[model samples]
Target: MPPMADIIAPQAAAALLAELVRCPSVTPLAGPAGQGPYGEGRYAALLGDRLAALGASVEFREVEPGRPNLIARFDGPAGSPSVMFEAHSDTVAVDGMTVDPFAAEVRDGRLYGRGACDTKAAMAAMLLAVQSVLAADGGLRATVYVVSTCGEEITGLGAKALVGDGFFAGGRVDAAIVGEPTDLDIIHASKGSGRFHIETRGKAAHSSAPADGVNAIYQMAHIVAAIERDVAAALAAMADPVLGSPTVSVGTIRGGSQVNIVPDACTIDVDTRLIPGQTFQTMAALIHGVLDRSRAARGDLQYVIHNRPAYPAFFIDGDAPLPVLVARACREVLGRSTLRAAPWASNAGIFAEAGVPSVLVGPGSIAQAHTCDEFVEIDQVVQAAKLYAAIIRAYGGAGAPATGARGE
Candidate 1:
């Protein structure tokens, strides 16, 4: 094995990204069999093969029957902690992109494709970095695990399943690094988010006889107005120094069966973003309290929260060892210090909540994520690979055991 600094190169990262982008692993939607642009099973298999070729022990963890996750581990010396590098394999739908989402085209220093920037680039860079680390005699003191997961754009089912399966059992891992498009920044915190459905009930009657029945639509309208006011006030009163404040918005609403009849039922879908220290139960209680107070004022209106959790938010302290290691690695390899907070949500929150000290680090810009012309700069890809190698070298050095290493 060669030294870590001499084993990685820019071209290697580009090649990996190109191969991944060509797979067209878009988010799955209900559609004809094998007709959607997502479902990254093929790509996962390809990556598994690559990991095996690099001497890593690979396992295909199936979260769903058709959707699989790839977990590959490179063994190091004994007694060191294991570090896990995590990334989502599935991408958001390329519904309105102007470019061919699967082309993997490179134009003007940017690689244009569906998952190129959102995350595939990070996966590629991480893989290449692992290869470089192996080439170097730096031998890991702890094992390094690379996980490509499913359902990041939707329910985070892959991550949830991994947690439920005891993947983090025995406390082998000291840290985790979630490869999101952070432009090489280290994200120590992220806002939590959840979706809710509010339903109001009332008696229906002919529109011509207003006094004969209750109007559920009117009841819902009042509740919606109250939510807007109450939620806005809550946000205004509390703001985090890093993740800002919690927010709520009504995303959808439906009511009424006919124009001439008074509607007896109405539903509103709300999206809520929570800062650290908040939870679904607490938010639900607050919303219910608002509704209860409003109903008391109205005398005849009632509502209930129906939506379940879409996802949860997580936040780690900025000064945690994981962030410290990641920032130091970035500065040493990329010549720049990294930021420590992300405004949006990602799977890192899940890992953090599960007791894994995880930091978000990767190539590309978040602005390009889920956008039409999604792309990652070639330079960022190369730099990320080098940074990953440096992290491995710093933690796993030659003859170091794989027992207590963190994956930040």
Candidate 2:
């Protein structure tokens, strides 16, 4: 390994972030004549080269047909515990951005571009942290894996593959640190999410004829109203202490072909958030119970509900060594302790389900994610690098916590 002074610097990390912003690795990867590079491969390769420069063995493994996740590992002593730092490489589409999405422009102490805050900033920080650790200590007591995963903005295909397939050869991970914008705070718990569609079918009839056909729109209105009154209220009362309450929102609705005809069918898409101790099955059953009562009352509605898979909510014990290590890193490096729960779902939840204790920590703010003119403060990115480096030194170097097991 190289010496600390010769390893990548904070400025190099920022420059690397600019290079990533220039790739335009949009989700639903599309690469053709006019389209941007596909599967985020361009940016993945760019990151891979940087990792390789720091003596990490890098591999690009396919998660989907064209989309791949980049896995890089820095070796340590034989049989040493291992830890992972993961960040997504993909960004949401830059459809309505107010600024040039790929320019990588810097102004007034900020870097402006898509994926700047949502994730790429954290990615840069983690990379530099690993570089710094390897440079200063030759190796670590724990082997470290720095994963730049793809498809986090959409399907989470990358994390799924890595966790399900044991993509890393370094046995089981002792801890996984997922990077997301928390304004440099530490997140040990988060809500899960589920999506489903509700449809009500009815007979179509001419609008000129009154009371000749069942009105699906009217029926759906009743269902929506019932959900708002019954389901939402019930969920609100059964809140999770850390994640607050589970909630549902009717996001999109469609009905009626034209105003001249009574609609034959109506459909609504719903997003439901889940807190810990709530399973998707239990939530679906509750929804069905409410809808059934509505059906029983009217005895005149025809409706169907279909639910997609749910992302399970997760909470790690706050007093655990991982959080302790992270908090110590923050206090020692940044002179502050910022710990909170994130409202949004990330791959961290999925990792928890796989029995890997995970936490979300990084730079910037979540508000900037997926927004037009999205940017990350330059100072935040630099501080994030320092924080991550401190964590690596504290947990992976000689000062590692003594109480945690491999999967704790």
Candidate 3:
């Protein structure tokens, strides 16, 4: 088979990424599915059709009512390893952007758009590599599932459904390569995120009679400080070596409804970055302890915590075959490779949680992800294609499947 460079023209590569960026796939809000450009259905349609044209069997399965995930399967020899290349179909909100979000413009060799750096570039690279190998007669080495998952930006719903539905045809895929902006490095470990709202309740009263009503907002200040000071210290003591310390931050706060009324309720949304060993249960206990400490100081405090869905932490030992092969593949393509950790999470973690041997890799710098001017270096996208092709080939040739590598 010819090299990917010979098969994929430079313009063709850029054009593919440009086409993906041109689609509007911002993660949708709580609205009717497929009603507008906000959901991933339209983008999934484009990818599904293209993958189908490339001789893959495509399936559009909805994670939500209209938000479908694009699953495309490419056949190989029957006994070969099955590998999944998962690139998210949704981007962060386009609330703040210096460039036109869906313009898909190229300037000074940078492909600029909303999802350009965060993941659309990775998706494009995966598509090109798959296409190149498929063009060669009987050159496809692995059974590949090129999946474009939806709802990865805010919720991991798409991944959850994929796993719950057993999308792998009753057999686990050998290795899953989750695509994110990794500067072409292999990310085997990443911090997960947990989000929840902490609310404090109090009796309402008029401003003139403030002493009669307990102030929930004022009490919540103590809880926030305690979490930052006490809970953070406790979390640091139990930090993972690779992913480092778990962290907590307060994002949005709301208290009194009006100026003159002593508000009966106040809530603060909290975000926590979790290490591998931490779970939602542990996070709740730690914060509950902090809240208890604050309650001991004042008797009138009333509090409740409302939990939200969490993205899991990802980790695998360095010696594992998945990471080893990925590193080798990158080195083969770019003359070097780096295995590292990430503070932010991705679909990789959810796969890891489901007992799939998973790792994160792809083009572009994370600094550009979700930025006002989100863009990916065109060269990096090309490198990503070659890297993925090499990795899939190597994984297929290996005698063993990727499993039993993650630690508790």
lDDT of each: 0.80, 0.81, 0.84
Worst 10 residues of 1 by lDDT: 399-408
- Model 1 Cα shift for residue 127 (angstroms): 0.4
Best candidate, lDDT-wise?
Answer: 3
Q: Candidates' TM-scores?
A: 0.92, 0.91, 0.94
Ranking by TM-score: 3, 1, 2
lDDT of 2 by residue, 65-129 (tens): 65788988888688766788999988888888998888889888789999888789998888877
RMSD of each: 3.0, 2.8, 2.1
The residue-by-residue lDDT of candidate 1 on 135-230, one tens digit each, is: 765456568999988888877878888888999887866678889899898887778888889898888999999689889999999999998998
Candidate 3 lDDT by residue in tens digits, 86-109: 999988878869999999889998
Better of 1 and 2 by TM-score: 1
Q: Relative to the unseen true structure, what is the C-alpha lDDT of residue 9 in candidate 3, on a scale of 0 to 100? A: 58
